[model samples]
Target chain A: MALNVLICDDSLLARNQLKKSLPADFDATIVTASNGLEALTVLQTQDIGLVFLDLTMPELDGVGVLEAIKAQALDCLVIVVSADIQPQMQQRVMELGALAFIQKPASADKLAAVLHKYGLI
Target chain B: MTALHFTEEQRDCLQELVNVAMGQASDKLARYLATMVHLQVPAIKLVDTQQLPQHFAQRYQQQSVSLISMGFFGDQGLRGEAIMLYQLANVDVLARLLEYSDDDSSEAEMLTDISSVLTTTFLNGLAEQLDNSFSYAAPRILSSRDQHFADKLAATAQQWQLALQVDIRYQLTDYSFHCDMILLIPGEAVLRLRQMLDQILASF
Candidate 1:
């Protein structure tokens, strides 16, 4: 059985970057969303196992999306992928129940590690 | 006699200060771009306010400039010294530099969205280094009109005729793109800044 994962961000470059970095052998269907609002739309319709999200986005930021996910009690792992890597920013994402705070343009190794830790790889 | 103003040499000193600030800023930009970012050594200059129109037209003839201005105050009175002004590059430039593709229009909607994070990270770092309180409201966009630009800046430096301006350029790799960062420190603040740097050096 393959895991289903979602990649949500406002940048097409980010989606392309995620595709190139994800583990090739990992059997999962990776879905992409443009922002938080679309991520939620996809969630309502798909069986997603995990999410890699960007923080500063329009139509809803990463924090807001995290809240929506929690509000609906969705059983999916959430990881924040952002460029804002200040120490305080890391704490804020962690406090929001994000499984991990992976900085933007995360390396393949980092992505693999996060997925493996959650048994989603 | 009017208050003493910053010469090219004094501007160079400030450029060094800017280099230190931007070097730290590049680290944050690299994380966002998902690639290494390097800033080149800047060419420092001291231009009168009257020369700005000719300077803008002659030097940046083909580029559309974008300005982000903010008010700074601490250890000195209210002074509008920090501004991140850059040429708004194409999406392709932003894409390659950021390691993103041409599909995200939202990414280009506001300079504040992309550059503001870098500014905040740099300012916060500078504050830590200077051991001073540094905070500014969100940066706002502005035009480069001679009269309007001069008027706004003149209001900030009511007592002083000349101000110290530091200009630095940021080069984005994995793509051929660059942006400018200009800091306009008031005459009073310039002396204070030099003193602050000396104090920091003494500590080391």
Candidate 2:
């Protein structure tokens, strides 16, 4: 089965940038949400396997989303892609249940390496 | 509203750039105070000189504020100003955090120190991502006492018509400190900035 992917961010530019940086060999179908609430709606309605989450959004933020995912025991892997590079933030998100963290303006190599590390691609 | 001259894509790009830059700045501030810093999504607009005070009223609402300004010169003949407006209400709490004495000079010095961290971290982050170099002047206190910042700015900018304003707010987790940093790209600098934005868009 082709896994479904979700990219959630408030900024359209960030969404597009992350979308374009996906490794060529990654075969998941791409889905998108502009904020955390929209992301939750999609997660509930679809069989998403992976998610790229951003912090510091309007409505519910990425941390809120992670907490909800943990509370709901959602069945998808979340990798955080955000501009909030504080060590504490990174630790908090990973503790909340993100599989990994990637800084903003992510490169294809970094994305590919993480995917490979987890055998997602 | 007369031809703001920024395309939706350019504006989106600028906002994201600001998000990254402001994120770095907030991290710097958070580490400095050893507290979580909350950041508002950066707001960008082009406004006439007449509307500046309304913006002030809408955001600040007659609050006493301290202000500082720094000028930045970009390599592409782009020049603009960075203004940091610190709310005056919570100075005592912040003074305790910084361990500064309660004298006016000490307070002024502390404000400048904090302002220096924010302005330089943010502007340098923006410049680095844009692949441009910049030089900065020493920080200047526009109004560090009882004066209203909006009134001083209105009097100062009567000769101008348009300004590209990027407003960022930072508040500590305990609400013991607050500040608004406004970056203004004026006149021909706006044109240069638009070109830079387009170039960035082209790269991706």
Candidate 3:
């Protein structure tokens, strides 16, 4: 099976951008969840390897979802995509076990570098 | 003098102050967006919470506008001393100007991603300035979206005693957008903001 990726965000726009930014040569199947709650549900059934999560959402924000993922002991890598790019928030997310943090509207090249650094690409 | 009012002279000074601050904000945003943006000061209104909606309606020509609101609390805590409001158009154009896009995605994500970037950039810049000058960390954007004008103003009314009102217009090419930033704070916080402003003025 190709690498399964889960994208969780409240904004439809963010999901689209991450999908578009994926490296074309990478063989990965992308799945999306509208919010952290939905992401938790989808994650329970899917063998997701990576997650591109957003911090702010209507229900069960990103930080909450990260906690849930941790509580469930799911072996998934998290990479946060947020508009709240405060250094403090970044540090907090990193401490929570996210492999990386990508500010919003990240370019494909920038993302590719992040993925490569994580050995995910 | 619980309810402070700006005299005509003070109003002009405040207007110029906001203009300079906004000019710097736009310049920072332009750098982030990689495009030029022009801002126009249509009018500045000093109103209480009750008069906010009517002012917003008249400004946007009775059209429901998409609004983004954020609050900043400095030194003394929850007495939010400053806040920001950006029209959706200003945000959208800024995103476009920044060339925000993904190679293969639906239009929706493109917009969301751009929205995220715009929020981050605008908040970060404003926060840095406030923090540097007033020891106020950049305000945290609690949330951002295409919200109705009435809903936005109503929600703001609950949180603050409206301190001041700034009406601004942003334009580029064929697109035009308007914004109303209503500064809100507790009585004490308002005093701090004024003091901060005085110090900033003195330094310059």
Candidate 4:
């Protein structure tokens, strides 16, 4: 079965970049959300297997989304992709059970490596 | 001058870090604009709140400016604000460089988008070098028109006793446009940052 992936970010440009970074032949049903609230709604409505999350956004943020997932014991994995390259932020997400963290302008190679490391490929 | 909030070594380290971050931000801008963006040697200073208004006025004069500002926080109560200021006269020029239609709405949207990317990219670059994680609020447009930019900055400076200011000049070589990016880090954050630097220096 193809994994269900969600890309959540406020910027159209950033969301597009994350989508493009996915492996060309990767098999997955991808969804997109522009903010944390919408991201949670999608998580609840869809059987999301993995998430590419951005940190800074209005309405809700990446940390809030992570907290919501943890609070509800959601099964989906999260990989943070953001321009907020603070080590503490990365540690916070990881401590909250994020599968991995990737910086902004996510490249195809980096995405592939993370996906492979998590055996999501 | 008043006693320096940061020791010379700490100041030097911070300047180097800011330079690296500015370089990364400029590279991203270069790719976005499809042109080379040059950054002047950044000037970092620690100044009192009373001096901020006068300092900004002296630097920017009477130019109407557009400002994008955001707040960021990290572990151990580290926090600061990053503000990007551009002369209002160049908005249309910037829109054209970005290949957007020369309309008021388009210029506004493009300016916000560009500021968002630049500010976050620069902050993230700095965070990575410091080996720390930070969370930032979404960027907001403080002003998008010609106005007393210095007065506005001064008013905001009232809440803080001291601030570390990093001033950078961003020049778009292919286009006749350049702007100043200023980072205002409050004294508390600077103290924490100094601790982090000391730790790093000791490690090395």
lDDT of 1 by residue, B81-145 (tens): 55565555553577555554454344344455566776666556555556666777766655442
Off by over 4 Å in 1: A1-121, B1-15, B43-47, B89-92, B95-108, B144-163, B201-204
Write down the lDDT of every candidate, Cα atoms only: 0.63, 0.84, 0.60, 0.77
Worst 10 residues of 2 chain B by lDDT: B155-164
Q: What TM-score would chain B of candidate 4 score versus the native chain B? A: 0.90
lDDT ranking, high to low: 2, 4, 1, 3
Error of 3 at A80 (Å): 44
The residue pairs found clashing in candidate 1 are: A13-B100, A13-B101
Model 4 ranges off by over 4 Å = A1-121, B1-4
Which lDDT tens digits does candidate 1 get at residues A77-99?
Answer: 88887755545556767887789
| Complex DockQ per candidate | 0.01, 0.69, 0.01, 0.02
lDDT of 3 by residue, B92-185 (tens): 5544654655332332344444334443443344444445322334434423444466655666665666556655443442455434455555
Top lDDT model: 2
Clashing pairs in 3: A13-B108, A13-B109, B33-B98, B127-B138
Tell me which of candidates 1 and 3 scores higher on lDDT.
Answer: 1
True contacts kept of each: 0.00, 0.59, 0.00, 0.00
Question: Which pairs of residues clash in candidate 2, taking residues 3 or more apart in a chain or in different chains?
Answer: none
- Write candidate 2's Cα lDDT for A1-121 as tens digits: 6789999999888888888889887887999999999999999999999999998899999999999999999999999998888788899999999999998877788899899999998
Winner by DockQ between candidate 4 and candidate 2:
2
